[model samples]
Target chain A: MIKQISKPPLAIDDSAVDATLVKRVQGGDVRALGDLYARYSVMVQKAVVRTMPRISDADREDLVHDVFLSLLKLVNKFDRARVFRPWLYGVAIKKTQNFRRKRSVRALLLRQRATNSEDNPVHPPADGQLENAEIMEKGLSSLPAGQKDVLILHAVEGFKGEEIAEILEIEINTVWSRLHRARKTMLQLLENEREEPGGHENGV
Target chain B: MVCKYLYKYLDGRLDWEDRRLFEDHLAHCPACLQQTSDWQQILTVAASLDNKDVGARVAPPSSLDVQRFETMARKRIEHLGRLSFLGRPLAVAIAAAVLLGIAIGVWKNEAPDTPHVAAPAAVSSRVAPHKSDTSGAPSQSLSEAPLVSPSATDVHFDTKVKELTGSETLHASAHNGQCAHMGPDTLCLFPKSRAEVMVSDKAHVVALQSGSAVFYVQPNETREFRVTTPLGTVVVVGTRFSVTVTPEHMLQVVVKKGTVRVEGDNEAAMVQKGAVARIVSEKSGIVTRLATWDELAAFSVLSKMIEEVPAKPLHLKSAKKPVVHDAHQLQDTAQAQSLKMLDTWRKEMIAGDVDGAIEGLLRYLQAHPNDVDARFLLATCHKRKGHPKEALALYQQLAQHQTLSVANRAAYLAGDVCIKQLSNPQCALQYFTPFLDHSGRDAPQRGEALYYKAEALLQLGQKKEATQILESVVHTFGRTGIGQRARNRLREIQP
Candidate 1:
């Protein structure tokens, strides 16, 4: 597990230190690279965790490493005239999204094979008691990626619809609509489950 | 319309005017309120499902990881260095020509005034001088080679301490723009410039702060000589090479004799004779190309060798380890006067003062509201005091920062509190799923994370996935404590 320390967010006004460090790193200073790592490793890790919430620790570490490597490689491409945070955030989000996309494909293929295999059943007896979480997972798994992302980001991550809209590159109304649909779908699934022969509401 | 309002109202996505209208409508409608209540119940349960698959967030890679990366980066940089040379196909062919002696043969046949057609002439010129035997076969041609002048003086340096490994070796001084005769067979020549360098005799290493230095290592010697720059390290067994740290702190290694290894970050490269390797940054762009003769001209002048000054024997012993004390007790008073840091809370908790620890953390949080670690500690103390709801809320808040080192643990704890302490297994499912998802195969808590996820699945009547995860835990982690519990649970569920 990565050891994380809490520090205040980097002041938006403090681009000077970042500039000097960037210059040093561009100049091929390995120690300066280490300094940059110390400064932003946490921020990058947080971005990975928040964006790809289900990613493992080791994978997260590798992602963080890749982020720094990308930063170093593309440091020249970065517009030093602008703020570093937004650019870094964009890179982090893109990398995480790519990771999720690739993983999703792999998982989908695995799930498809399982469904195709007659020997491998889809699930055990439906008579097994349904926990609220299990029912929700099933509901969530059934939702589309866009809806699932919005639901998790808004409901679980506590991001505002507007904030999520910008983060996910969708409209604010889209975020709202997705959140609403996600919730509606979850409720519908739960309601349907309750109507079943042996099903109970599993009230909170 | 009722579903729309209830869903939007629960999500807090309703417009202000709509919200007011909904409130007015709900005030008179008991049925609407009940519907809202049921939806809220589902929403609350759905919320827990988000964190169910997450594992505790760890801190960034440790210092050890950083060091390992550095070593790996060094090797990669060296490899990239050679790869850069390969990028220029012309340079590669020219290097091949030099090795086959075709370049030297062509050069020997050409008139002295003939314009050098290739960069190999200048590169080959440097190595030719050092290979001369006692009769000076190669040095005989030094006059004909425009780059080499036999008038330069031999530099000298005092031999410093030597160490085998796992220790530091000290050098006497650096010769700014001057060459030094390192030993009987080793000759180190520095370009006319300003730099600080430390040469270690036993380890055969040179630490350069700035400027460039060329080394002529006799081929017969079996020992390796290494040059350490601010950017990377260059290691050579026996070679004629020059290392320069440019103004941009870029490390460039030019090989004139045998191959030299250049390492930066996680990468390494080997620079063949007449080839130059440069690391522009820690990034992937490593340049290795054939060096033009003009670029090799800087190393031609050998400085006046300064007389050797014997270094006084300075014995260095390892420093004794410091005594350990309670970090909170000693650090809190020293670092902060008013604030009770996490150490203090830890000390209180370890002393079995759960109330005191909770109070201290609360007081600390009062001043440092952004302190998630303190919040996490407070939640742990709350759990110890058997206040599951309070702890769950705090854990949720801490878990919001997915990157937090304790976030995964907080998520797991939240699930545990909800399922075991609060009897909300549905909520536990949310936290447990995320915990299982993010938990690495090597994580000590993986068994528990898997078990909890299974338990949540079983509770939700999802027996297949639950059974699979439970069986996995039992089989994979059979020797562990949680694995035993998983086996027992599996039997209970299947029977």
Candidate 2:
């Protein structure tokens, strides 16, 4: 007879070093807060770049700096026991979202101006060094925000679904479902491109 | 049972009982067996897509940018320091003036018979209970204290006291001070004298204070090491190998060359070429073992490549060759009948008639109660129809038998069903624990048993316990998909 399978166990424990550093920062040690920022800035930057590629390099650095400064303001309210990586990523995700929205507005305005003009029409910036990056940016922008967030956090950032849930304040199952859907959609999009003549030439 | 546990089986999330039931069903039910093959194909497709590069790229931060950012950070800290000292006094002055104005108002409003207006003492006492008890009293005195002890006098006394205690504490802790930070592909080593160990969600700190010690760190992993000996603090990256310390407070190191470096006492050495170094207490060290490859590879964390070794080839002996019999005469009647039953059930299942399939299998089992095939097929049908509880009961029955091959399969299926379908990790544990308990050396399912057991542990929130099980699987199975999965899960949990 086919035997009934059982589910695996789940474990939870507070990370001690994370807890200590977070506690110190919350306790008003600016140096501890700075140390925390220095530690996670690269990871946060990578996650942001994956999501917000269109942002200028200078602007990306500024965004990263602003995230730390914003985090500094809220350090006193952050929970010491909770893992800080996901929380910081969540903040970075929000910052990236804000940056995208501002860019979108600017693009919309530019399009409107081009449409109103009789002779001059605004063209998109040449692909240049960011051609592949632009395609990825466009693909990500096309995804639903929730799905995009889950995909970036899980696939690109190498976080587990459970960690993504903690960062996004969602259920673990939600993370899984979003990841599944996002992967399916990305596959479908890639397949569509593959069917087009010369699409493979673009090195996706 | 097979149907019920299919999802769990596919996800590799099944507990023991369900996994057993699913396997039992698969052994007997050809239709469910085919379904598993289809599921495997789907997984292959999914994995391929996941591995495909989608053009998300990253360029490393330029060295120039790092320099500029560090300079800016230093300036910001200096500016904040100046602001903090100057801002605090102005804040206190404003607070004092507000308090004085309030006190004047209260004195002016006091009636002839009013009970002394309590001289702000009763008001302060009443407010103390409402505010934070720790900081409330000190803040209340901010206005009163500055009037008695001017800011300059208090600042001088505070500085003197701080200098006396800070210098002593600094010297005591300075010996073992080491700080290390790890990013995705970079390990940053700071001076041991100024380093303080702090571990966050993305980083780890290990204090290695002995004169010599060996540490084996695995790749895609980061560990902060603090060394207090004369040669300085050494930070290493990647896994596999050990470090040994000498009695003279020098570090003798050997690395299989993932990445290793010694930083301290105004000197740094990058130990490449799988070399060994004898770092003297005060002098720059010499690196040896450069002629031949370092022996540290053996000590390195075994890679996932180890698990890929195929099962040992089945041995065939000539001495006990089977006597040939006529095909019709040799076929066991019971076995033939069971085969016919499986055929009919498979046809019914293929026709999309699950009830017919289940009924046929159940009758076959009723006639031959010990017919393992029929029993397993029935359980699988029930499982596919979403009857996990029933599948569990059936798989549990077969898993207890002395038949090693059949029992092991049943146990694995049972674990799968419990984990995937019902999402009951606890129930899954019941089935998986036994399989692990009984698996012997060289059993094909032994590695699988440990892996599933760990999965069950993980689902149940017993992470540390699960980590031990996963570690065992990695040690045993090495390069197999199961071992790779275990390693991946370990990374997820460790940091």
Candidate 3:
């Protein structure tokens, strides 16, 4: 029997094109692989930027590389039966999370050494010279990864709750709850920012 | 309670029933509307931030980085190509043992009869098998008959070769065949029941017109070579393998060392060492099995002596040119340059520089118009660059070369482009029909091909025929993705 239908079936735009490209890549068609990379590298970059807001250019590039490398090696294992974008999103998320974990371990080591590193452990505090974009990035960074993922995918990336849930491998109801809580937390943070000394009005 | 519908409505994910209920509630609700308005502002901010991150902040990997990665990947792929034989080490060891055993057996019995004389370049004449006539050879005739005339297309061999003619009147009469010596390698012909073979002077390729032969390719041969038969093609870099066509029209390949890829009909399979691949008549399918007597003669002393000598390590010529060359270094240089050009084209294509690759390929094709491989590459570039009309034109040209290795896949891709990109399903049918007709029943994309044809038929207002095709797909490929797609289409039509 068909499982419960998600609110929006994850339909990637130009999915047939993606399928053809995938088949060609499987056949070792280098041009098709290059086209696949050209088409989706931007999406992968966006995912890293949002999911990992404060990452360095090098780290971000590394994460992007890892995502594509994983795609290249493991593409044969991908179920062509399913949509490609959701699977790709899953890879991006997992790679970013792995990077985050590695960074945390290094941060812990630095802390033990009492190293005065400029970069924060995870999410750095908003400094005095924060612009609107930086402040917004800081706000998204403050939320838990799950909530950040839901909010960005839903409100930012324009994916539906069901599609987000599929990418995150969660329930639609869970996606809604995460979204609601994320918004609540965002409002509270903005309110707190407004009341801070020398702080400007909340950007949002 | 209204919050659920509110979230869905804001996200634009609310179903009809939930949307109607939410609207009815919104008509009477003030507090919810104010809350939604506040939420809308936050959402807009979030959307803007995402847009800014993508448009201004997030940066894709630099082209330099991509080129580095592509370079590394290309090296890795090339390494993998060279190491393909390593995947079946045990098979190789076992095949080597069995082959050695057969060789030793033949040598023990036949050693005393033949003289230990090195072969001459032109041994076309057959002498009676007697030790008194010319030293100690008993089974094979010594060279005495006049040399057979060389073909017009024959290359300038370092040494002359004797062509053979079997007696048409003698049934199963023994016609002793001499091994053709080319550099360090040897080509032995063991034709059974009216087999004809052609040996190339360069020793890089052989054509079997109507029989079986054993090729003991020297390991020093760096470039991959091919043995073409009427029924199949066996490609290998360096290996000991035999290609034979059975009376039943099955093309059989037995790999005794390294690995060989057999391409015939609509399929191709890699026959590793000790493995036998039988291409059924008409290239319907390939059947792989363990090596048996059919692969090589049970007793052949000459075959045994070949394995007794260790293979020389291949010394590749240069980094720029990897092909191993003989004394005819000029020919090798030209071939190597062509290969290097193809590699450059591949790298360009993979870097998303289709325009550059297309220009290069077009120019290259002008000089080599009969190079179907270049045209195929060009067709793929067009397909990837969203030029369906150009891709179709090239594919149509390629489809005509039925003997080309990638013709089936090229035809299928052409049809796929037609149905998916061009919206010319009627045109797709022309290619799809031929592809389906040629493809075996168990071909992987048969179901998808059928579904595509069915969709085209439906688009042409042939619903009844389309439905029937869908039913066939659902019944035949019931659990596959194509089957599921067909089922979904059937549901839409039936409902």
Candidate 4:
């Protein structure tokens, strides 16, 4: 037999720890919920900030709290066979979507439905950020809803096509197409803004 | 310039061979290379956007917020309660019962030895009248009490805070004197009083801005009832008391039923029951003394402010504008100004203006004859003015007609007049018997009632029974002045 070089056993599986914590949470141990919050609060908060960049600090913090509350209330409904991180990540995304949906309704009520990102009065870009990032943020707001979701999941969340497909419950091909459309639209909008300032307000 | 596999390659849907083909195509096509470079910049933007400190854009973390979250989650879990064996209808019923049980438990824990003492604000006239215990049954002792809160007449604290986090700081102010029953007891504010009252799991604090406030604090081991003033602070572990800031910059703390510590000007003193503490200018330190008759008379009605719960629902006849139909708010605030009348009378009584105060009460009683507290205060002023017949008449009427606490007090006062003023020992026995045979430890004036009962017994020539009762008072309250007087009485009778 070939010489078997023994390597240290692989690092402990995080899922096992998560499973134990989840079991404790299901058994109504709120301390376990606290533990889960301590572990993943920063991650959930990061996802919220990235998704809603112009969100006020209070709104983002409340959104993070809402995500954890949903997890605390619905931990029993979680499928144990799956990984906890992505499931929580999925929870984070869904809650953010729900929040955005409500925010959109409020915006509509105020008659501030802005088709152009730069013209949007409800969420203005704050001072002191990368110039290119601000332009990208404006351009991203102009993209179609489906393409924007897929693009954020792929590029920002660092999920591959298959994972994005799983998280968003879309076909792999659909994820590819939407992201392609998102890039094309973003690039065109950025170019128009550079060439002619007010010409991009009409939207793609 | 547009390549078919460009997005597939960008989104990682392309195989290695296809990626190789795409790279080959990119190498050949200058237009596609520019397009790919532009797309890469967007990807870079997305990559750098991940976890940017963004701290400036968000609120900082707070431990209090975390605690509130934990409390809210606990309440949510209470909502998501479990039921396995019971059927659906029974489960619903059981769940409702469980919620009610939790509410009652919270009520009992907050109000340990106290009974429901008054009626709700809306219908006190129809409700409280029927509850007057005119039946001649002997009052049961506290140990044997069922520990039941008479639910029908009282506004349950649990229901008031069911929709809230139950830890909010209530900011209450009154241009005129206003009385409100919060939690287990009532807080009555003197005219022009302003206070921030916060009763929470963490602490019970009343930050007094101006005027005087009386607190009948529920006994709690975890937190002290603190009244902070500009001159000094009065701290009570758990008791009923009052705090006033004098215009001369002296802080007066009067303790009716508990010990309080007064702190100011780098001086502090512990004030016990039936005493007062004066926090004067820095040089005098804090002086503790037995409450004078005037101070006691002024603050005594405040401790009994709990009886004011249904005294009036507060209709401000002073409202300048007409009704808006849903003038519930108007009603609540309207009656707050009316309490200024009582405050005026109270000030007059303290200043030895008994006739003026009695006239004010007579006027107020004409419009609202059923007001128990005003009527009782009127009787007290009559006694102070040496009108024993008038005081006795009012006290007997209130004893037979008023609610539990005021009625108990009336009976005790009636007994006092018979012994000290009228010297009618037989009349004293009728009034003193009800107060003496009381089972509950919450019975007010128990020591004095017992002492006077002994005096009445001796007057009737029951010397042996009188001696035994006097001995018991000396044994129980030896540290108090009443106990010293009982010892003196005991010695004179035995020899």
Off by over 4 Å in 4: A1-20, A42-63, A92-138, A166-169, A184-204, B1-40, B47-75, B82-495
RMSD of 2: 28.5
lDDT of 2 by residue, B386-468 (tens): 79988888888889867876786688678878876777877778877876676566555566557667777877789989999
Which portions of model 3 miss their true places by more than 4 Å? A1-12, A49-54, A100-145, A184-204, B1-4, B15-37, B48-56, B61-72, B79-495
Task: Write one digit per residue (lDDT tens) for candidate 4, span B143-257.
Answer: 1321122221222211121111233333223233454544443355443334545554434455554334444333332333455554455654333455543434245666644
Taking all chains together, the TM-score of candidate 2 against the true structure is 0.36
- Per-residue lDDT over B302-394 for candidate 1, one digit per residue giving the tens place of the 0 to 100 score: 211211222223232324221122233223322232222464565466445789778666755675688665786687678767799999999
Candidate 2 regions off by >4 Å?
A1-15, A27-39, A102-148, A166-173, A182-204, B1-211, B214-226, B234-495
Superposed on all Cα atoms, the candidates' RMSDs to the truth, in angstroms, are 23.8, 28.5, 24.6, 38.1
Q: Give the CAPRI class of candidate 3.
A: incorrect
Compose the digit string of candidate 4's lDDT tens values, residues A64-139. 8778777766887898887777788778878887888888898899999634343112433446654656787667
- iRMS of each prediction: 19.8, 18.7, 20.1, 28.5
Give the CA lDDT, 0 to 100, for residue A45 in model 2.
74
Q: What C-alpha lDDT do the candidate models reach, one value each?
A: 0.52, 0.46, 0.54, 0.55
| Two-way lDDT contest, 1 vs 3, winner | 3
Chain B TM-score of predicted candidate 2 relative to the true chain B? 0.35
List, residue by residue over A61-166, the lDDT tens digit for candidate 3.
7777667755556778988877777678778888898888888798887885323243233433435423533555667767887887788787766676767888
